[model samples]
Target: MHKQFSDVDTVRAELLQNLVDDGETVTNLGSITRLEVVSRIEEVTKKIISSLSMEEAPVLTLKSRSRWSNVRFSKLVGLLLTMGGTVSTLRSDCPSTVMKFALILKALSAIYKLVQSDSYVTKRDIYYNDPQLFGSQKTLDTIVDDISCLLKVPRRSLHVCASTKGLISGDLCYLEEDGTRVDCTSTVVPVSSSVSGIINIVSSAKFVLVIEKDATFQRLVDDEFCINFYPCIIITGKGVPDVNSRLMVKKLWETLHIPVFALMDADPHGIEIMCIYKYGSISMAFEAPTLTVSSMLWLGLLPSDIESLGLPQDALIPLTVADERKLNNIKKRPYMSFHPAWEKEMELMLRWKQKAEIESLVSIAPHFLTRVYLHNKLSYGGWI
Candidate 1:
């Protein structure tokens, strides 16, 4: 492995050199191009088709890794993992395994067809492709996920897409590969899974602010947060993030080389979501190099702020048994241990036995979040 650089400027410069261009078949994200991916799919599909035509035993091979076995924590990169093993179709000897193998092939064929047509389809689209065979959306989603893991590529690279569950507002414009011109500064738009495939970006934003909830995002947008103060981008995962939002945030931070801060409820769930954005999720740990935003800071509704800012007592909620369990679970994770500030915050929350939402800020003042909280945090550099 090569030496990893902690310098943000140097990393950004290296990533920028790999951005895609017209007819460019190379990238630092993955040297593999769309056309190259298509060819690979065709080659795999042709081999299977020929085997069946010759009355030979049809064999398939998938190289994948298990999260439980493969994932590990890294101080610099968060959860990281490597893929290994070539699983053969011969493993499908059992009645149950046979059905599972068939499902995998069906998904592979669907992906191959998608590449052949030079188009893309969401997981929902794939689910509906063979509703009877695929059954529920989860079933199809799992199969597609398995394929990505097996092929050692992102779902996007395979043309299997997901819906946009995040919203964005900022001083940014970009051209999509399909010729869709997106001017984020014009209006709030959902950050689609297709964001990674965008042709180019033109932005003058100084930084990006990622809010945990859509309501908070809307509040910031309503207040013209960017227009009033700094020319910056504001984004929301709407809850837990979908891939597009995460990818877009990662892309912006890498390309623009700007500060990225997260605002969330002062609770375990919110902290987990924030961690996912900064350090890639455990399930997709292998993709951390491209997906995670290591520089993102926690700009928040901190546990200390509940008292420091004198928020209404009524706004605080007692932690449920479930919430406590979640916090305990998070505390056990390796990454959490590495961040003493985060550990201190979790300790504060556990001591209080209560959690508060960002919306609770309104109890102190209707415009408090945008006016007082965020302004003070950004101005005073109050982030961890």
Candidate 2:
């Protein structure tokens, strides 16, 4: 008989020892087979290697040659795709990461040598362009897999925590949220500031003027006038203001019984911004249930002021079918349900497609603004 140490017992001992070393508690030492023991050891070793490699992951720094070539290839592909899908032909013109294997195969062929025999080149030339062979594909695959997994999940799920304050983390600082690492510390600070500012103002003011543009807000401050002639706060910056700003403004108005007057440009984007502010449907900004400020009002860009301001004929951007239908439906509702001024303004915008900017009226004659507009709009006691 061949000398056979008990295979099953030996394997079970080995697997139990490996599991114990890997911080796993083996409940039954006798339960494992030799094959299972070997497999478990391999798996544990692979996990250790993966963790070490991740900790030692090399930073990808773009050199001048790499940057230029990458940009050139990207531009070529972008242009080709833009011009009716000519990317197949353009792929032949450059070696891009997207087609690295194909390019390497082509470069190795006799055809490639025949095309460039006289040219003097160094191994560095090929190495710089094809660094992946020298680098690690495993690392790249891990990163890509992580990104793919992240993209499949809902953005709100990425937040560290959700509270009445705002999204704690996992918000896309620039675009829509992905699993891309963001400094939660940096994002939360500004949100806190915005919340604090809103709380401060809402506690004091009888009404808040949420001005979309800084320039228009400056003009209002200079002239000492706003829609409701009440103390106001301006949301200055690009796109829609952040979630914290909207929440702060909304809570202040709702809790303090202070009304919010949204004054924005008369363009489609501007109107959409006001609607988002009033009704809270901007999913990208915040995930909370829709919060409509019952006291909120739209109070600028009246139809009667358009012709007098000499605005461009093209200033009248067309309303969408949805907007037209909304305005029409609002008109049929009882007067007590909606503000008469708001209903009238929406109807005028739907019919004429005309919009007037607050800037246009700002440049009007001082006499007209002070005597005719301001005096009529604001009472002697300075109430709107």
Candidate 3:
């Protein structure tokens, strides 16, 4: 067995001292309790009722969360809601707004019951209650986020959770809300049930690796990568991470105070996904303080590595039209101005006219990623 990196604690701790996450301040991560959610629900309900009593069309002024115009970048907190940000109005009397306005109230009614009952439901389950009204799961997703932003509460606080889309493994143990003990040291598992309800997190891991793709994560599992590293936690959001995974990553960084590194493809989408984990997304900027881990370290296969490692010409994928467009947009992001290393790596990929996946490391050897490349990078300080 490849137990070359058998020592997890000492080496991991050493890395902790050497590796740093520049903008990781999760101490101020915000959470509201079930009682608070109920309180806010009651307050909002009363205002609507008061408007109805006065025969006035009830109007809701919500923070515009799904737009770039509403966000501001902060070196301290990453992307966040701008001060006195852009607002959108939803009026019950307006023909264009009435359907959505009704939908929001119905969803709120379900949420109120869930909080009071001390239970939670997935966004899918909520959507199913009246699918025709919601029109699509995407619409319900929007409504849930809109309500969260309007109330300035974590979406989980609304007694709603997204369908978990991430996976985890490696040296860590914790209790779920139902008192289910989860141990990730030996096997891969879903992130956790009701992540907000998890408690007593305990880990001896040296660092956390946020993987970009599930296929690569599964490859690591088959190679027993974590077993070799002993106490290193590895996770994947599958692709663009959902809220539960983001919260778990933020929580782990705050609690463990370990170095968090992102292992991703040398593609533009992969880079954007890592940025979402580190800098927060423009669509959900209002929740950046709790949802982002700005101190994220870049692990490989970086764009520069594709050339340096000499991956096969065929393995190097040509950038698609969409890829080029996304890369251009990524270069224009606010953080790009500060990260010249990122700029240099991107330029290399553009000049090469190719992108590479973590899977391409297989060309070097079947176990090159686990036995050679990763072992070397992780054992030593080989990350950006």
TM-scores of the models, in the order given? 0.85, 0.40, 0.89
RMSD of 3: 6.0
The C-alpha RMSD in Å for every predicted model, in order, reads 5.6, 22.7, 6.0
Model 1 misplacement above 4 A: 1-28, 34-69, 83-90
Instruction: Report the lDDT tens digits of candidate 1 across residue range 139-249.
Output: 887787777655556778888788788999989898886889999885898786677668688898878888999989999899998888678899998889888889899
**Cα lDDT tens digits for candidate 3, 166-195:** 999988999998899999888888987477
Best TM-score among the predictions, by candidate number: 3
User: Cα deviation in Å at residue 129, candidate 3?
Assistant: 1.2
Instruction: Report residue 270 deviation for candidate 1 (angstroms).
Output: 0.5
Which segments of candidate 3 are over 4 A away from where they belong? 1-28
Worst 10 residues of 1 by lDDT: 19-28
Best by lDDT: 3
Poorest stretch of ten by lDDT in candidate 3: 1-10
Q: Is candidate 1 or candidate 2 better by TM-score?
A: 1
For model 1, what is the error of residue 83's alpha carbon versus the real structure, in angstroms, after optimal superposition? 4.7
Q: In lDDT terms, how accurate is model 2?
A: 0.39
Compute the lDDT for candidate 3.
Answer: 0.82
lDDT per model, in order? 0.77, 0.39, 0.82
lDDT string for model 2 (1-384, tens) is 011112333434544454455454443222223343334324434644575577742111111111111111111001000111112221222445334324323333321232234232333344444466535433333222222121222111211111232232111122112232333212221233223222222123445556666566445545544333443333432336554556555544444554555667765556566655654331221122212343355555555556645656654556677766655654553332335556556666877865566655545564444345534433332111
